[model samples]
Target: MQVQPLDIVVVGGGAFGAASALELAERGHHVTVLDRTASPHPDASSTDISKMIRMDYGADVFYHELAEASLDVWEAWNADWPRALYHPEGFLVLSAREAEPGSFEFESERVLRERGYDPQHFDAEHLRSVWPVWNADRYPEGYVSPRGGWAESGAVVARLLKLGRGAGAGFVAGSFASLLEDGSRVSGVRYVAEDKSVRTLKADRVIVATGAWTPVLLPWLSDVLKPVAQPVVHYGVDDASRWQSPVFPPFAADMAGSGWYGFPALDDGRIKLGHHADGCVVDPEHRGTVSEDHLDLARVFLAESLPELADAPVVGTRVCLYSDSFDGDLWIGEDPERSGLIVAAGGSGHGFKFTPMIGKLVADTIERRENPWLHRFAWRSLAEPRQEAARMQH
Candidate 1:
């Protein structure tokens, strides 16, 4: 229904893309969102039932602050829409009692304290008292955050897509072919629609939020962004009451060691669980099917660490793809080789929580707005590998 050249063309309709389209459209830019699948449809990161979000990432101060801001945004939007987009069940970081004071959990507690945010540290007995259903003996200590939880990504993506559509942004189901380039500047995108017809949409600016598909579209940046496949599983709580849940926070297994993680019981009678670190390197198109072994790996960790819900039966499984940058941080800025093209991907695994601010940053970059955080995450800055980034202390 739009006639003139669009102000921005966004490739990929996942959370980042939808959020980008929503923000740009809200800014009065005629926007077009192109995706092979429908918005919030399967295969997109945003549609996966839930994505764990919290402010206890340990050492990543920028991400920690951004997460806090994002929580406020999610809460406000949930209230405004009167919808359950975010399930604010809070989060827990589990670790050993004497596991060095400088570890990520310890540093996170320090950071939270400095910011006037209290993260309660509990011992085995305290953990038992707090969560009787969980096995306190598995870990000596745990840090509980009253202000973190999981977001129903699919629902949020659906809401944003709807809002964007209502705001005059066009959503077309198609496969993004390539960037329409005039030398170094990107003009628009060519896509094959659902009916197999190829159409070209022209725009002044292009934002690529293809998630795991970022490197494929921009082959030149293959070394910068590596799409990784992360498998997540959901287990049904056989006896919900058997676990003295205590509003079981979104938990991360041994913040020092990348292992188990899970959510509180949802209204749908399923709890989400996954690994915070380990995942297979897989391609977006030819990814492996979620299998029983994947589910077992998640279950085994939860059982050993948090014995309360270990015996739960597997309910469902999903694969989460992370566009990992060389430094394991996010890449959100203009491409070095292309003008008028803003590349925003490289989630690694923890990008979902900051979708709102990321959308704002991508919009700002497209509009040439000055922002400190956006500047820090630019393409040029990411040229150097962040080895310390992998050992996040926030």
Candidate 2:
């Protein structure tokens, strides 16, 4: 079976676009990636200091399997890249109550054990002895899995773009205006160039990987895809050593219940914390500042979970926008109504960790290749929004 290489254009240069461009170009396609800004767009969700890398999806075995596969590639990237971007220190899944059935902590541990991985269970006493920074009494049941950790997300995106360019994918800076169509088939893209001039790039196929802006670009999908904004805050710590790995790894503090999670301190002593709950709908162009209510909630959570960080000076803050679908699962398949058009979006806040696998997934979808995971992400009718298992209920 001889497949012809076609000219392809990918919109967005974040994790999905960069990964897709790299994969498509490597597969012999003439690929071009267009973005409003350069790679690692400052406002893009993928442009963050750190993102958790864990296979703990509670009872969702599908995501757990995908994450496990992604982790193997993350390790391989760490070994092959110019510098290590992924830190495999470990991940602590802390629960405020006992590991009861149907709980995120319990299901994650049970699934890990069932798959032959030994996640170390911990109690109040163990937390006090091993990770003294945590309020032992607040987190009574938890587990630490050595298989997961965090990654420098922005750096990873940059690396992927660089790799994509090196693999013969063209990079262009422009703001996408609309999909150019020849009748019912998408022919290419019309964009506003850096100099404010209109430009058009023709392609045999077009992949729109524009994260939170997906719904905005394709208004027809507005009902199924939305832009939701989540808050992320960074606090400066006086003692970085106490908050670094081997002491305090990346962790979820009753995440499914409280939506609170944080990473270990960076070299400059900044600890990044974020909430993964039901965020308010937002316009991608006008993503507002983090609300006072969210900061107040963070303060309260810290006061009870990590007392030392309760009043730590706020170093930075940002509203990370997610391309949320009706269901939390990603959308990556050709548009049924439009020939030569494919979409790859719906990050939903948990997509960065799967960067390594996203490219292959997008490539598979583009080629109509037989992949086991493609069916789950294909375009379909909207249903009741069933978010990921680890997402918190507000």
Candidate 3:
């Protein structure tokens, strides 16, 4: 059989890769997106039930800017379709005595302020007075951003996948085996389709947005991308009305202490809980179960920090993967060692909030274009290193 040449071949159907395909396809590129499974399918980060979409980047100037820009894009899309892609419920964070006021958590507030955003601060006394459901006596302070909120991650991915199809981008269900290369230049991608047929498609450019499975596809960058497992559990409370407090924002309890974060109750009466920046290192293909100890930690956090939901039942629990970088930043751009291959992986746990902007970033990088945020997250930079938990403050 004769091989057909394409303009670009993207090796992941996740949000980043699908966004890249849509952006380029709209620009008239013959794009083909190859993925291990059809999009909107489970097992991919982009299809998770929920994802945070907010502008509080916590002192990362580059991400702050991207978040701001992504908000505009999300708004534009919402105006076009009127779906629940971005919900502006605001974010509420309670800090403890152990945390400093102007640390990472505080710095994020500062960034938002510098960008002309309005975020309210509440001392422990004020927090308890405003929200009787919370036991703010345990915390020193709380921060509330009326602008921060949640987004339906899986729905957004599904919508984009549908848009990509309407835009003429081909979606092939397959697992990326490896890249077909000629010397240092990437020529195409080798993958096995859902039918178990091995096929190779040639392209002018190849983008690897495989998320946690990125290292498995390109073993040469094993040291750069490490997959970590984090515990995530969903709870159902008896009275969802307790979450209807006016001051309640998608909140974090230990941002002042242990870095725990969670969302407000969804319309479905479930509130999610998980800690940030503290996941166990594991392989993407072989993730393990969430240990009993981990569940105990979450239970204790909810019980000790949130009195209203302390007795809530653990309705659901699952393990999520975080593609971590040493410095907790993402790896985005063309690979240094290979030509025609661009990477946009290792988002740590913060990539979701920047989906629209990250899509633009990946699209721009793949086209050899200039993007402002690229200066902070270069394709090949060794200076910015990832250090293990220095402080648990969110």
**Which prediction has the highest lDDT against the true structure?**
2
lDDT of each: 0.76, 0.90, 0.75
lDDT of 2 by residue, 247-273 (tens): 989999988778889999999999999
Lowest lDDT sum, 10 consecutive residues, model 3, at 385-394
- Model 3: C-alpha RMSD to truth? 3.7
RMSD of each: 3.1, 1.6, 3.7
* Candidate 2's TM-score: 0.97
Model 3, span 1-394: residue lDDT tens = 2233348898887777878777877777788988877786577767776777666656667666777788888888788865757877777766676446556567777777888877888887887788766777788776787675778788888888788888899988888888899999999999898889999989888999888888877887677778888777888866666664364567766663576888766667787787775677888767887778978888787788887677888888878888776666778888888989998887777777777777667777776677888755566544555433222322
| Two-way lDDT contest, 2 vs 3, winner | 2
Query: Residue 82 in candidate 2 has what lDDT?
Result: 82
Q: Higher-lDDT candidate among 1 and 3? A: 1
TM-score of each: 0.92, 0.97, 0.92
Best by TM-score: 2
lDDT of 3 at 31: 88
Worst 10 residues of 1 by lDDT: 385-394
Instruction: Indicate whether candidate 1 or candidate 2 has the larger lDDT.
Output: 2
Reference-based lDDT, residue 252, model 1: 73
Error of 1 at 115 (Å): 0.6
Please give the distance, in angstroms, between residue 376's alpha carbon in candidate 1 and its true position after superposition.
Answer: 2.4
Candidate 2, residue 71: lDDT: 95
